[model samples]
Target: MRRLLLLPAIALITTLTLIAPTHAADQPNFLVFVGDDMTWTDAGCFGNSEVRTPHIDQLAREGMRLTACFTPAPMCSPTRQALYTGLFPVRNGAHPNHSRIHEGLRTMPHYLGDLGYRVALTGKRHFGPNESYPFEFLGKNKNPDFDAIGKFVRDAGSAPWCLMVCSNQPHTPWNRGDAEAYPPQSLTLPPYMVDTPATRKGLSQYYAEITYMDGELGRCLDILDESGQRDRTCVVFLSEQGSSFPHCKWTLYDTGIKAAGVVVWPGVVEPGTTSDALISYVDLLPTMIEAAGSTPSDEFDGRSFLKVLDGSQQQHRETIFAVQTTRGIIKGSEAYGIRCVRDGRYKYILNLNAENEFSNTVSQDGNIFASWKRKARNDPEAAELVESYVRRPEVEFYDLESDPFELNNLAADPTPAQKDRMAELRSRLNAWMAQQGDDGAATEMQALERMSPRSADGYRRWRAQQRRSGADSAD
Candidate 1:
């Protein structure tokens, strides 16, 4: 096994400097657009010809597109918390879906506030202990108040402001966009998905929702333009995660953790350029801090990727990590937790509770997956695909180049070189777990500690309802 170069992470960032305040005028304003459950490949800029995302395509033409951005955690709450806090989900104590952060953790608003920026978030905040994420919230709906966004940007005058606008489109119950625009028979499904009529309908609806989210993103960007802040503001668009489908939302596969990112920073970033630098959601906070003339704290699991923005550096991280805690999610796996490490090419997944069958809403309750099961009776390929979604080994490895969708596993009976690579990745993953105080299955067992009281109550209520109908699925 040849030793992989631990170039970026091995050396700790030590020269962190905190400059004096009054930096509002000198620093630039920032506006971030977040989309819910949007698959990266669906965006026209990323390589989809069917799903029309004209706004995202326009942004890509005027900015740099990120080809290898991923969230540290796949679920909504964990991903949002990690992005806001600049800490991995487990370390921040928000590893589970519908979870809350550990008390006393200072998030992006705190750090950016200290740097003289009025940080605010509008729409779809799935974090908790609300104080931890102290951004001047503009609205509480799934979509942003465009009037409020415009007023906020225009009111800031010369003072630097940071606003993150989130959209709830393209999530489950995908009903936001015009399904008519995407014909069921004309759409091309990903190779991983089953091609049944139900699957096509679901995918078409998903794509429609994506187009709707793109419109939402365009609205935010349009606000900046109307406010005359477009040139001065660094606009960032992020497609949160994959849509709700089999082998996507609740797993650590690329489709689950990978995200789409585009940035437009005038005079700094080159237009129409794309980079393959790996960026984790945790890196956003420190990047914001560094961009504002302050140094990133050593405590951040991610460092500033501002250099990637400025075009000074082409690479950011040698390896990126992700967490998937199926506990506490709606129709989730009881205790199936996953951890994985990926570099430029290969990936290693450690399924902590692999003995238990993996089950989620897509596999058990969704119409699309039911179609898959129905088709499986007559289609061997559909049967194989359906079976793979719910069952897995303790270890899974993939050569991403050969398997972009992660369809094949290379962990069992691997070649000597493949074994070495897997071992090396596993070693790094173990070190990361230790650093986050993530005791694998032990950490997963304490998920209730991380889940918020409200979320837990809701889960109990749902379980009770299931019992009343004589269809209780609680284990």
Candidate 2:
């Protein structure tokens, strides 16, 4: 693996001074836009002709498009925590969904705060312990408040600022856009998705929500332009995780963990460029810290990718790892703990509790999942896809170059070379787990026990109702 290059003290001082010669005391401001449950290929820039995302596409046309960005977890909270703390899920104590970070763990706000930057979050409070984050709470609304955000930016007169604008679009119960505009019949479903009326309808709604999110992004950009911060601020747009669909959200597949990333800094990053850097969400904090002219802490699980942003380096990470623990989700979802490691070509997954069938909120209540189940009764291929999703062996491997969607599992019958590669990846994953103090099942069980009894029982009833409504049936 290539290590991040660090400059000497004198060279670092010179670089910082040169980057901000006009306003030596003022560091560059950061404006980050995060989307919820959005896939890497959902926007127009990523080749999704069905979804209309003119604003996000414009960012790609005028900024740096990162092709291989991924999150540390498929779920929202875990991924957000990893991005905030630059720590993996286990180490950060937020491996499970709807979980909090370990006490006394510092976040991006603390790191940027020390560098004379005012860090504030405008949407989605999915993280906790007020002291650990301490972000100036700008407000929590799923939709972007352009006027308020503009006011906030304009108010940050001199001191550097880092503003996080999070959007809750394209998530579950997707009902925020003009669904009629995206006709179900005209949709192009992925190979992993079944073709049915319900599936198409669900996809159309999800695409519509994506378009809505894009419009929101446009609004934010307009606000920045109005505030005269477009040229001075480093704008970063991130698609947090994949959409809430089968084989997408809550899974370690490419559709689940992969994220779309774009960075626009007028004087720093070259416009209309694309980078194939293998960056994970865990690297965002460190990169932003370095971009703010501050040295990143050595305790971070990730390193600064400023070199990649500045076009001085091409590769960022040789491998990225992801984790999933369903203990804090609906009750009886304890069986869905998984860990995965992926490089440029291959991906290896280890389903920790593979003896039990995998079941989560998506599989139980998602419209696409319900549609898949309905289609499986008559379509053999759909039935096979459904079976593959619910039941899995202990280990699975995929040659991502050939099977980008991870449809084919190569672990069952591997050639000699494949076996060697699998062993190497397995060893790497084991070492990472040990270093993170990941006890897998034991940890998940403990998390489950920590949940309130009432909440657990409520979730159990909710899941039971879903099962009774034929949501879990393949007939």
Query: 135-210 in candidate 2: lDDT tens per residue?
Result: 8877656556667787788898776888999888877788989999999998898898989898888888889899
Query: Pick by TM-score: which candidate is best?
Result: 1
Candidate 1: C-alpha RMSD to true structure equals 4.5
User: Ten consecutive residues with minimal summed lDDT in candidate 1?
Assistant: 1-10
Clashes of each: 0, 0
Error of 2 at 120 (Å): 1.0
Q: Which sections of candidate 1 miss by over 4 Å?
A: 1-17, 460-475
| lDDT against true structure, model 1 | 0.85
TM-score of each: 0.94, 0.91
> What are the RMSD figures for all models against the true structure?
4.5, 5.6
Colliding pairs, model 2: none
Top model by lDDT, which number?
Answer: 1
